[model samples]
Target: MFMKTFGWSFAISAVALIVAFIYGGLEALILCAILGVLEVSLSFDNAVVNARILERMSAFWQKMFLTVGILIAVVGMRVAFPLLIVGVTANLNPVEAIRLAMEKGSIDDPGSYAYLLHEAHPQIAAFGGIFLLMLFLDFMFEERELRWLGLLERPLAFVGRLNGASLVIGLLVLVASATMVRPGKEIDVLISGILGLVTYFLVRGLGDLFDVDNDGDTDADDAGALAKSATRGVGKAVGKAAFMLFLYLEVIDASFSFDGVIGAFAITSDPIIIALGLGLIGAIFVRSLTVYLVREGTLDDYEYLDHGAHWAIGALALILLLTISVEINEIITGLIGVLFIGSAFISSIVRNKRVTAASLPSVDQLSS
Candidate 1:
């Protein structure tokens, strides 16, 4: 399964090696390889969340995620998206910005592409952070039988009794971050955060609007509720539902990738190297990871895994919002995610063993 899943990754890596050698040198190839591994490590939570979302989608859309969605991840979000942000923030045209990013690959200099991305970091962080906060918030508030961290999840669900509670929390985070961030960055962070909040609502709104409820239940008073409550209907409508889900997942992917692009700069800032190394190879691996999880029904077996991923996401969101005022290592963020999800996975295995033992017949019954 590993080889089958990551077959393209090998090819992409080989190509990245050649590309790096041609573009920069053997040094660049080494940096590209490290960036790819760093990306996979940093974004494992993304794979978990993606598996959850992908489970709801149709088989065709699942394939699309492996194919078309990956294309978007490598080409659109990870590569072009970073350039677009730099372009907009630097007041350069897209072409000019791409040129600047490709032409400048220095990591130590403050005037480099990576540094310029840092200049835009707060806004990038704000945008991704808010979108991710909404995702994390929704998961926390979602009513499900599975509970990974009951201590926190249960209380959160209790507070979730209030309508718009999650939305309120999201707004509060935005406001708090604005105040807490440095004065020079306060306005930019807030504006970007607000835009991120609006983008979340818009995506959820579109999903609810387009994912038609065939059951004739028109009671969608709470948009947040509708976001998860409205499960996809059957047969022909499945295609539409899956397509909407694809859009939803892509947005989620986009939210998960901002820090990745910037963090890759910490290794090297050659735009093509970043695009091919981190973007392509890492993206293919992630998609494969998502597919593997769903195919194996890992989520069904490990009930609390999604919960852990959400906790990690919540942590990442806070880090992004706080990055404006604090220096956070990408390694720390990745570790948080790894610890949360890894603990949950172990917990799930233990729980499964307990349940299996409880269901087994006693010696007395066997004798009878």
Candidate 2:
């Protein structure tokens, strides 16, 4: 099953390596491999969190995610996104932007690629940080007793019924906060925060609305009705859920890519190198890591892993927000996630041993 899911990953990576060899020569290949490893390591927690949502998706959607989704990630974000950002922000023509990004060793020259990246850093940080903070707060403060908007509870029950309205309110709050606290870049911050919130709520709502209930809750088992609710009588809720899941996945991917995209500026501003190095490496691992999480049932086995990842994501978001006034290293953000995930893994192993030991019969009784 794992092989079936991840077989394409190996093929793709191999192809990428071959292309790198031909186009970029040996140096490019070596750099791509190293960057791939670094991206994979930094993004393991992201893969784990993504797995929780992806595993719940139907097989067809999963395939779409791997194929079409990968194209969007590698081509759209790694290549086009940066260029677009440059064009929009710097008022540079696309051709000139591409030219500036491609001059070999240009990235290291002062006031060249680095200056451009630094200029845009505030906006990138604003978007990534606020979006991540919202996700973190939602996960950390999520009410356990109530599922999906905490409907079982009173205050939350009212809040849950607001459906899409809560998202609007969240946006308003974000806007208000940005305006009050950071007046200089308030507009940029608001735009980033709203985009993140809207994306998350839409995706998560679709997931919740379409989710199948297998735990035997009769009220929750109305799959047909659940599937039908999201569309304005156009499609099944499951379809909507799948679409939402796709959106959710995209947002997550975008958030994960933000640091790498920005950091790639620090490497060599060759758009080709940035695209090939980060895209091939990061894309391959996302697929592999997603499969690993699904196969291992990591979410089910390690109760705290999701929490840890969410916390890490939240911390990253916070760091991004702080970047408005202060710089936060990507390495630090990555290490925080590693530490949290490592602690969760150790805790899971210890818990598993305790459970196994409890289930075992006493040695004296066995001897008798």
| Candidate 1 stretches greater than 4 Å from native | 105-111, 212-237
Task: Looking at model 2, report the run of 10 residues with the lowest lDDT sum.
Answer: 212-221
Clashes of each: 0, 1
lDDT for each residue of candidate 1 in 113-147, tens digit (9 for 90 to 100): 67788788888888899999998888788787878
Candidate 1's C-alpha lDDT? 0.80
Model 1 residue 294 CA deviation (Å) reads 1.4
lDDT of 1 at 83: 82
Local lDDT at 157 for model 1: 87
lDDT of 2 at 228: 41
| lDDT score, candidate 2, position 46 | 83
Clashing pairs in 1: none
